[model samples]
Target: MPPRCQNILLLGGSGLIGRYVAEDLRLRGFTVTAIARRYVASQRTSADDIEMPIMTMTADQLTHLMLDRKIQMVINCLGVLQDGPGMDTMAVHRDFTAKLLAAINAAAQPIQFVHISIPSAADSDHTAFSKTKRDAERLIAEAGIGSTILRPGFVIAPAAYGGSAVVRALAALPVADLPSDLASRQFQPVAVDDIAGTIAWLCEHGDHTHHVWDLMQPEPVTLGAVVDCYRTFYGTDRSTRIRLPGFLLDLGAKLGDATARLGWTPPVRSTAIAELRRGVTGDPAPWIAATGIVPQTLAQMVNRRSATIQDKWFARLFLLKPVIFVSLVLFWIASGFIALFISYDAAAGILSAHHFPTALVGPITVGTSLMDMATGALIALRRTSSIGLIWGILASLGYMFGAAVLTPDLWIEPLGALVKTGPAIILMLAALMTLDNR
Candidate 1:
C-alpha cells in the first residue's frame, strides 16, 4: 500500500462515496484534493484536515489542473443516469473514463487512476450500459494507464447520500417496486461507508496493473425482503408491489443501454436499472472471489430507527412546492406585463385591439399551458421529450413579434413573454423527468 495514499485527487469528491472516501483518506494521513463540478467555497468537510483545495472545473479544466497541481492519485467517482444526450451510458461508463485515463497519463507526475464501475458490466452485449462500461474498460486498458476499476453493487448511504431526501421519499411512498418472486432473487446491498472503506483499502495498497474489483455485500436478499427492511425501519406504509415482467424490463434495460450509447440520459441509467433487476436474479460469487474483502450486508449498514416527516425541516414547508410554483407563475405574469410595455403591446395593437391583448399574452399563456402538455406527452410515449420541449420553448417565445415592434423595456422584461428562462428550462426538465426510461 505504499504506507498510505499521501496525495489523492478525487474527481467526484462532492458525491456520496467521494465525501466519505475523502474523509477516510484524510483520517489515514493522506493529503486529498477533492475535485467536483459543484465545489463551493463555503462547503467544508472533516476530510479537509490537510487543508487541500476542492478544485471545481469542467472535464477539460481538470486536465490542466492535474498537471499544474501535481496530483498523485486520480479517483474518478463521476456518475450519471440519463441526465443529457451525451451523458448517457456510453459517456458515463466509457467516454468519461477514457478522458480521465488520458489526462492522468498526460500529467507531470505519474498519476494512478481509480474508477467506480458496476458488476456484470463488461459484456459487450450485456445491455447498453454494460457495453459502454466495457468500452470504457477497454479504452483504459488500451491506454496502458495505471488504473483500478471498482464495480460495486447498490450502495446504501441514507445519512451520507442525503439521509434527508432519500428518507423522506421512501417514507412517503407505498407499494415500492420489487422483482416478481423477489423473495427468491439474491442481492448484496453494501453501505456507502463500506465502499469508502474499500477505497481506503485500495489507495493504501497502491496495487497497480489494470484491475477490476466487484465491491459487494456478504449476504443477498430479495427485493421484497429489502422492502420489508425499509418498512420495518421507517414504519413506512407498505407499498403496492408491482414487478415488471423480466422480458419487458430486460427490453427496457437494453433500450436504455442503447440510448445511453447514443448519448441520451436523464432517464434512469440502463446499468443501474439492470443492477436493480440483477439484484433480484444474479449471483455474486465471481465478485466475492475477486475482492477478498467481505462486504457488509444490507442489515449491517441501514439505520432503521423510527422517524417522522418533521425530521426534515424543509418538508415542514409542505407549501414550498406550491409556493415555488405560484412564484413561478407570478414571475411570468410580471414578466409578461413588462414585455407588454416594451414590445408585445405594440404588436398586439397591430394585430387588432382584441387580437393584441390575447395574442400578446398568447405566448405566455401557451408557454405555461405547454409545460403540462409536454410533461404528459413525454411520459405517455418514448423519446418524444425533445420535440415536446422544442414546442414548449417556441410557445414560450410567442412575444417575439410584439417585442420586436414594441421596443422592449430592458429594465422590466427584456422580451415580451420572456423574462427569466429558468422556468421554461425547468418545464423542459419536467418533460425530461417524465421519461422514466427504466
Candidate 2:
C-alpha cells in the first residue's frame, strides 16, 4: 500500500463531478483545496476555494501552488466537451495535462495523481475532443507518476449540466423523439456518488499500482431506455414518442455550433451529437472488483428520490432557455431595424411632436435605435450578456420615464408598445439569471 495522504488539491471544483467530489472528500476527513475559474453562489462550500484561470497557468505556477499548499494528492476534474470561443480541445485536454504532469514531476514530495477521463471506443479518436483526451491519457502514462485514470460513463449527478441538461430537457418536453439509430445506441450510466465513493476508497486504501478503470453499471442500457427512465421520473412516459427526423437534429447541432462561436456552450453541438452517437459503454468489472462498489442501475438512480417542483421547473426551463434568448435577440434587433430604416420618419415625428427639438429629432431617433441594436448584439454574445440585459432594462425604464414625462398620452396609446416592454424586461432578467451553464 502507498502512503496515506490527507492534503489533496482538486481542479475544476465548480464542475458537476468536481463539486460533488470536493464535498464528498471533505466529509471523508481530507483537507481539499478546490481550484475553479468561478463558483456558483448557491454551490459554494466550506472548502478552501481558489478562483483562477487554470488553462493559462504555467507548470512553474502550478508547482509553486502545490508546494505552497503542501498538496500530497491531486484530483483533476477539468475538461471541455467541444471547441468554441475561449475553449480549445487540445489546449485543455493535452497541453494542460502536459503542464500538470510537469508540475507533478517537479514537486518536492511524491504526489498521487487521479485523473477523470472518458470511456474508450473503436472510433474514440474521430473527433478533436476525444482525440485530445486520448493524447492526455498517453502523456499521463508516460509521466511515470503514481497515477490512476478513471473513465466514467454517462455520469448521473443530481445537478444537471451539458449533456445531462440536454437529456433532462428532452425528457421533459413532449417533442423529443430521437432518431432510431441514435436512440438505440448503448449508454451505460454511473451515479456521481459512486465516483466520489471510489475516490474516497482510493484515498483510504492507497493502491500502488498505476491503474486505469472504467466506472459504470454492470447492466447494459440503450439511450432510449435512459431517456425513458428520466421521462418516468418526470411522469412524462405516457406521452407519445414521435420519431424526430435526423435532419432536424443536424440543423439543431449547426445552430448550437454557431452559438458556441458566440461564447455560449449549448449542449446540442456537433461534437456532443458525435459523441452521443458513439454511445457510452465500457467494462466496469475491473472498477467494481477493485473498489468493491456496486454501481447504481438506471432505475435505482432515478427512483432514489422523488422529483421536486424545482426539478420539474429546471427541466422545462432548460428547453425554453434557447427560445427565450432567441426571442429577446429578435425583439431588440427588429425593433431597432424598424426604427432606423422602416419607420425613420415616424420615429423622428414622435420626438418632434414631443416638443421643440427640430435639430435633435433625427439624431436622437438614430442614436437610440443604434443603442437598441447594440444592446441586442451584446446580449447575443455570452461574454457580454449580463451587461446587455442591464442595458436593456435601463433603456426600457428610460423610455417609460421619458414617455410619462414628455407625452403621458403616449402611455395610453392603443398599441400599448410601452406596456409590452415590461414583459420584455422581465424576460431579459430571466435570461440573465439562467446564463451560467456550469
Best by lDDT: 2
lDDT of each: 0.56, 0.89
- C-alpha RMSD of each candidate structure in angstroms: 10.1, 1.8
Residue 7's lDDT in candidate 2: 88
Q: Please give, for residues 1-438, the per-residue lDDT of candidate 2 as tens digits.
A: 543878899999999999999999888788999999888786677749778898889999999999999998899998998887788889989999999999998986788899998996646668888999888899998888888999999999999998888888888887678888888999999999999998888887755458888998988898889988999999999998788988888999999999999998888999889899989999999889887899999999888988899989999999799999989888889899999999999989888887947988888899999999999999999889889999999999999998888888887899998888889889989998888776
Worst 10 residues of 1 by lDDT: 314-323
What's model 2's overall lDDT? 0.89
Candidate 2 ranges beyond 4 A from true positions: 1-3
Per-residue CA lDDT of model 1 for 267-310, tens digit only, reads 33445554455442234555456555666677666544444554
Top-TM-score structure, candidate number: 2
